[model samples]
Target chain A: MKIEDKKRVLREMVLHRRFEERCYQAYIERKIGGFLHLYPGQEACCNGVMEAARPGHDYVITGYRDHVHAIKCGADPKEVMAELYGKETGSSKGRGGSMHIFDVAHRFMGGYALVGGPFPLAAGMAKAIQLKGGDEIAICFLGDAANNQGTFHETMNMAALWKLPVLFVCENNLYGIGTAIDRSTAVVHQHKRVAAYNIPADECDGQDIEVVYEHARKAVDHVRSGKGPYFLELLTYRYRGHSMSDSRGYRSREEEEMWKQRDPIFILRDRLIAAGEMTMADYEALEKETDAYIENEVIRFAEESPEPRVEDLEKYVLAERETQLPWLTGKAA
Target chain B: MAQIMYWEAIQRAHDEEMARDPLVICMGEDIGVAGGTYKATKGLYEKYGPLRVMDTPISENGFTGLAVGASFLGVRPIVEIMSVNFAWLAMDQMFNSAAKVRYMSGGQLAAPCVFRSAGGAAHQLGAQHSARMEKVFMGIAGLRVVTPSNPKQAYGLLKSAVRCDDPVFINEHELMYNMKGEVPDGEYFHPLEGSEIARSGTDVTLFGYNISVHWCLKAAEILDKQYGISAEVVDLYSLSPLDRDGIRKSVSKTHRAVIAEEDEAPVGVGSEVIAIINEECFFELDAAPVRVHSALVPQPYNHTLEKAAIPDHEDVVKAVLKMFGKA
Candidate 1:
């Protein structure tokens, strides 16, 4: 990566962390509501993989911990924040709240709420690409626990069978809500399980963004070059509880502190600063700029945005098939 | 017009649509090389080749979700669940994902995929297989549920469903595949909403859909000849919207109604029709509308018991006669 790209990526990691922290603050301030899943420690997984591929051309989907992924995929930070606030200007027009942020223009397919539900969808997108004879590949970012979903096994087999262009990036945060990988999954190592489907797999330390970016390049090449689906498991940890409701009583404090010591943001930022690629003043300046932008621009847009109008409550039910809701229309009953 | 079997109509629709747009594809177990179990997708695998005519494994949820996901990117995939019974495994994809994608994504995305499944009891397929799942699909909000009574309807509805820019669940009947009717020689797109007045009448309305539409027609024949009762057969093809205006118009004209369905009364097609009648045309009703539904039990395997378990033309006739106080 070029020096400029390295510095930019380091700044993106910091921006992602600050954006999520602002979301946590907004949740407490009653500015945002509904189920919010924040990605604090797993920044490298989304950034590293996405950086290796074209953001607006390629497809990206994940399971609910989506704010950062959408932003990284070129979704407007204001629009994402407005979606969390359930505003009319939100990404989903305030229909999906936080779990369903979508930017079709950016090719961020969506963030589905169901665990492992995106498995087949990713394969399907790849199949479409193959049908159209396009070079774009579909990438699905899901937690390690999502691998246990039946779609996981079924999709892997089909992707391999058809040689569909898709990359399965699993962020192994060690737990599915409260259940540990050992208790929930048979094979603790997620990449090894892909052997059953003959898919080439790799594992890397997710906290290290540079390592993630390096391995992800190979994975992206393998899938985009028509070698079929590739699985990349990034071993990372979450800083906060699973959701706002999670007290996180199930995990140990010592383990949390241990993982935090290897924080992905700090790792990338410190490395860039020590290499003379970025000065301490530059790092502090970038952090302050990102903080101000999130506070003044993203949050302010969300706070000042209007609520979705009531007339649109029944819209989007069908594309153009039924212009009106059957019941609501004067012609129906 | 060309006389064709119901399955042939479905096949022709697939061929026409696939030829019309290269984006349209078919996926299901046993649909490619072995042909579909009902032959609804026969010979297309050789014509369209592997990618377009995909024969998937026995993972209903996987392929169904996969097809819906493909629809997001402008690939129109028609997924055939071998049986509606097997579709139970894939309802999450159908109801939660395909149905809700457009609305949840705030119109930025659309899932224009069509899911076809053969349902209803046919020659004692056993309790598990003998499912009338139209009610389940109809209850969903984002999906458009349509059932075809004959070859003409099967062809037109499937074609229209493919062109439709929304998720549509075509609930086909296993018994109707071999049944024949005249289909138009030219391209035809059936309306996805409203009921079809299968037969015109004045004294009573026989409301039904899919297989039940045939029973209503048969019963209407018996009522016209034997009982001299002019019973109108209203084909409630659009189950999701329930054709409220068409249903009310028929019921108001007839002054009485008899809803015939293969499903049991509770929370099924019969119950929904009755609710619409009561809410829309209660004053037009001269007497209480009666429902002719199957016995409230899991369909039996034995031929004799199965015959007793399901509602047929005779039940529809009885329902009409009783409604007119001539039974």
Candidate 2:
């Protein structure tokens, strides 16, 4: 990879790491309410894959653990933070809250709450792109657990049959809430599951940004070149629990420590330094800058953003005025 | 005026919409080459080509989700679920993603698509195939549920549903495919919500939708001819928004109501109609509102048992006669 590109990737990874750490702190302080899923350990997977995909052209969708993916795909951090705050200024105008963040202009489809829900949506988007006559592809991010959902198989078959431009990216964090991959998934190798449909799939180390980026480039190129749906699996882990409510007694402290030692952000940082592309002071300065941005700018923006009004709660339910709500009008229109 | 079958009306509507808009596309299990199970999409593939009329695998959730996702990017996908019985598999995509995408996204996105399925019992199709899940769909907030009772509405409402900027669940009956009614030539858009008085009367109002509307109309004739009771028939086509004013006006004039539905009792369409009458026209009502619904049991495979399951002309007449103390 180019030195400048490497620095840029490292910078984005640092930003995502610092931003999510602050999000964790804010959640503890009760500033960010509802279910909070931090993306500290899996920053490299998001940054690498999203960086490889074109922002305006390619579409990105994922499950609820999607703070970093939105940011990486050009969604403003302030708007995203405001969304987490349930403010009107948020990306989804407070309607989606933390789980549903969408920026149509940025081509970030959304963060669906249901497992395996985004796959069909992504395939549909890919189909739409094909119908509309475009080489653009849709990238869907699924957790290790979601690979077992019926929608995963259904969507994969449709994407392959119709030759839709979609890349099904599975971040295998080894656990689906409390269930491990071995316990939940019949096929432990998530990428191998897609082989049943004759689609090409690859797996890479999610801890290494360079490796993930390399695999993502080939995968994105294949889909963008109209090679049907591609499945790329990143063997990763999550440092935080499933949500704020999860006690996380399912895994041990030693397992957490082992994964923490292979943190993607630090892995990239050490690689850049060893190659003389970046120094330790440079990494620290970048990290400090990102921390300052989130602590001061992002947090302040979310804090100042106004919550959506009670009156406008019914807005966006329907596109136009086809049917009337009984509560809103006292009678149907 | 041109008389056409229910399937012909639906096919014409698809033809007109697909010709007018290039963005409009259709997809389902047998919609392309096989021309749909009910032939609702007959000749669409040959006319618009395979790209516009897509034949999808037997994956309801998959294709349904794909349609919703495609709608996100401005391609209006008219998805078919073959039968409402199969719609259960795609309910997650329908409710979670398609129905809630617009509201949950805070207007950042909208799924202006249509999902049409041939539903309800016909020819003793048995328990699994006999599905009138309109009550369940009507309960969902973001979806627009419409059931057409005649060819005119099958044409007009579908044209309107295609033009609608929200997700529309069109409940087309399996038995109604061959039924014919008068449809005016040229383009017309019907109202997606509100009830239409199929027949006017002053004594009692008999409300029904889809196949039940025909029963109500026949019962109205029987009441007027056999008995001296003047019965009105109101077609509650739009189940979700439900023409509250139309219903109120009809019930207030008649002062009596008998809601006929093919669906089973308890929290179904008839129960909703009863609730509306109880709330809006309780004072106007002289007799207690009666619900002529199907037997509260799984539809049987036996022909005689299946015939006894859902409400018919006799059930509607008996309910109306009892309401007027004529039985």
Candidate 3:
């Protein structure tokens, strides 16, 4: 990667880290409600892959640990936070909370609550792109645990058979809630599971941003080139528990500490510093700037955003035919 | 107007819709090469080719979700579940993803697709194959459930379902595939809401849908010829967003009602119809609304036992006669 691209990637990973850290505090403070799944430790996995995606042409869909994915895909931070706060100014107009953030204009399809929901959806979007005569591809991000779902095998078979232009990404965080990957799934290597369908797959160290970018670029090229769906497994870990209320008694503190030492954000920052591109002062400045932005801009905007009224609760239950405002609105910020 | 078989009428709607819009596609098991088990998708694969008329793997959950997903981008996918019994495997996709994606996404997305499946009992298929699951779909919020009685409705309602901006489940009777009727010519679209009075009379009203509509029509003939009872029959085409006012109009005129359904008694269409009558036309009714539904047990495999389980024309007559204290 170029020096300029490296700096941008490092900054985005740091910003995502800072944003998720504050969200953790906000959830504790009872400001952000509902099921909160943080993506603090998996920034490189999203930023690396999403940066390679075509901004308006390519589509992105993921599981619910999705704050960074939406932000990385160009959704406004203010609107995203507002959605988590259940505010009217949110992306989904306060109708979809944390688990469902969607912006069609940006082509960030959604953050599905169900574990394996996005597989078939990604295939569908790819079909639409194929029928429309576009090389635009769909990237569906799922967890290692979701690999056990019947949707995984089913979608992979259809995607391979139909040769849908989709990149099936598995963010292997080693654990599905409390159950470990080896305990839940018979196949530990998720990419190999897709071999039954004859789809090409690759695995990478998600803790390293450069490695993630390199592997993701190759996979994206394969799908965009209409070589069928490519499954890429990004082996990473989460710093926090699965949700806001998780005790995380299943995993040890040592295992958590082990993953945190090689955090993606730290890896990118150290690489830039060692390359004499950025100093310790520059790194501190970036962290301070990101923290200030989250506190003053993102959180302030969400706190100030208005809560949707009860009277309009039924507004988006079905799309309106005339304007299609809220549902089929082509312009999504 | 061409008189065609019920399945042929459905096939014509599929053919016409596929011709009308390039976005319209069909996906199911054996639908492409084998011409569908029920022949509802006959000649479509040859007409539209493989890309448009897709033959999916036996994985109902996967293909159903894929079709629902395709609809998000404005691709009108008409997914056919070979049997409604097989649809049980896809209900998670049907209920959670397809039905609720629009509302759950706060209308930022909509699944404008049709899930066409042939349900209702067909001789000794046993409890598993013979499932009348329209009641299962009717209870769901975002779905439009429609059951067709004859050829015209099977054609018109299906065309309308494809065009509608909501997910629709067209529950066709497996036994009624050979039944023939006249389908009107040139651009016909039936509304996905409201009930049609199949026959008009004054003494009593007989309510039915799908196969049960034929039973009510037959029972009406028997009631008029044998007992001198003027019986009106209402075909409940749209099961959900039910025609409450249309039902009220018929029940108020007749002052009596008999709801005939192939499904069991509890929490079925019959219950909902009776509830509507009690709420809307209580004062107009001369006698309590009677429901002529199948036995509450699973459909038996034996021919004699199976015939006794399902409600026929005689059951409708017996219920009506009992209401009049003449049984």
- Write candidate 2's Cα lDDT for B129-188 as tens digits: 997888889999889999999999898888887777789999989999999889879776
lDDT winner between candidates 1 and 3: 1
The CAPRI-style docking tier of model 3 reads acceptable
Q: Each candidate's root-mean-square deviation in Å? A: 2.5, 2.6, 3.4
User: Model 3, range A160-240, lDDT digits (tens) per residue?
Assistant: 999999999899999999899888888899889999999999999998888998999999999998899999999999988
> Comparing only chain A of model 3 with the true chain A, what is the TM-score?
0.95
Report the first chain's TM-score for all candidates.
0.96, 0.94, 0.95
True-vs-predicted CA distance for residue A119, candidate 3, Å: 1.2
Candidate 3 lDDT score at position B158: 85
Q: Estimate each model's TM-score.
A: 0.98, 0.97, 0.96
TM-score of 3: 0.96
* Weakest ten-residue segment in model 3 chain A by summed lDDT: A324-333
In terms of TM-score, which candidate is strongest?
1
- What ranges in model 3 sit over 4 Å off? A321-333
The structural similarity of chain B in model 1 to the true chain B, as TM-score, is: 0.99
Candidate 1 wrongly placed segments (more than 4 Å): A321-333
Candidate 1, chain A: TM-score? Answer: 0.96
| Two-way lDDT contest, 1 vs 2, winner | 1
Candidates by TM-score, descending order = 1, 2, 3
